[model samples]
Target: MAFSPLVDQLLDALRVLPGVGPKTAQRMAMHLLERDRDGGRQLARVLMQAAEDVGYCQRCRTLTEQPLCELCESPRREDRLLCIVESPGDMLAIEEAGGFRGRYFVLHGHLSPLDGIGPDDLGLDALDAVMEQAGVDEVILATNPTVEGEATAHYLAQQLKPRGVTLSRLAYGVPMGGELEYVDGGTLSRAFMGRQPFND
Candidate 1:
């Protein structure tokens, strides 16, 4: 089961990635060593470069090499509406969906007291500073629909309440093409609670 020490090290390193098990890591390491050393070299170079260069955007806390991210620097984005998300990936998903013209604040993570993460760790002070001076009118809670995400959003709402900005949470409901019967109970309940009146 053991190859060379370097190959074992490569497999272990590959396993550090999310969802990459021992077998997958072994296959990847083997493929790199046996098939495409050039591709592996390119991957290593790019990975090292990105790891060394990529840092948090000062304005939004999302991953960026610069002091601010492209979204934060965009003149066309709506400064009045601020969308708060839990991670850079979430921000990217919202951006890709389009139509939203607001700025974003990435928390990088959610509240989990058991894990020792709190408001300070999430950079709530920076967000508080933003709300105080950014002239923002609306703050959208776009955190994921989970216990931790909800707790983080609620904590943010409490903290930002004094700032006087209108706070809103993203709507949770059944998908447009999904049947109600197939929808889970929690989703159905949330949809029911957030239902709107029919128009004339």
Candidate 2:
């Protein structure tokens, strides 16, 4: 059966979201049209407002409504310690984990030469400027465990080498509760390589 042009367009638009297939998009469109049109309207308004007003933080490159993000504006955060992450999502995850009081520099993406995403695209020049202006002493590379993430971390390490700033990459290893038997080979190797002496 064919849906109306408007309904079809909505479904198509919804399908553009990651992991949203045609069936899921259709269901979402139907639910919005039938069950909660008012909520849909509100969602549209909020989405439009956010799209228009939300922008990257001037200092951290993370999404924000103001010139500087809250973290950047906070006086309590450690200014010398800068954590570099591939996205605001990663920064948020680290924040949720707590105990990290340092400032952050969101790359907004990883380096992918094949995809034409270079250092400029990742805003590394801006990062360099921030490091100089903030007098950053330590930079923690918290990019993901993926291949691209590793490459990005290495590239950053080289780029910042001349700056004399301390550089470190986040350790990758088996999950706390994961069993060695079920762990993948790469993860097992990483765990063994990154192992630290157990505290008595």
For model 1, what is the alpha-carbon lDDT of residue 152? Answer: 91
Please estimate how well model 2 matches the true structure, expressed as its whole-model Cα lDDT.
Answer: 0.92
TM-score of 2: 0.95
- Candidate 1 lDDT, 1-200, residue by residue in tens: 69988888999999989999999998999899999999999999999999999999888899998989988888998889999999999999998999899899999999999999988998787887777767899999999999999999999999888878899998898889999999999999989998999999
User: Model 2: per-residue lDDT, tens digit, 59-103?
Assistant: 999999999999999999988999999999999999999999999
- Worst 10-residue lDDT window for candidate 1 reads 125-134
lDDT of 1 at 171: 86
Residue pairs in steric clash, candidate 1? Answer: none
TM-score of each: 0.95, 0.95
Worst 10 residues of 2 by lDDT: 170-179
Alpha carbon lDDT at 115, candidate 2: 91
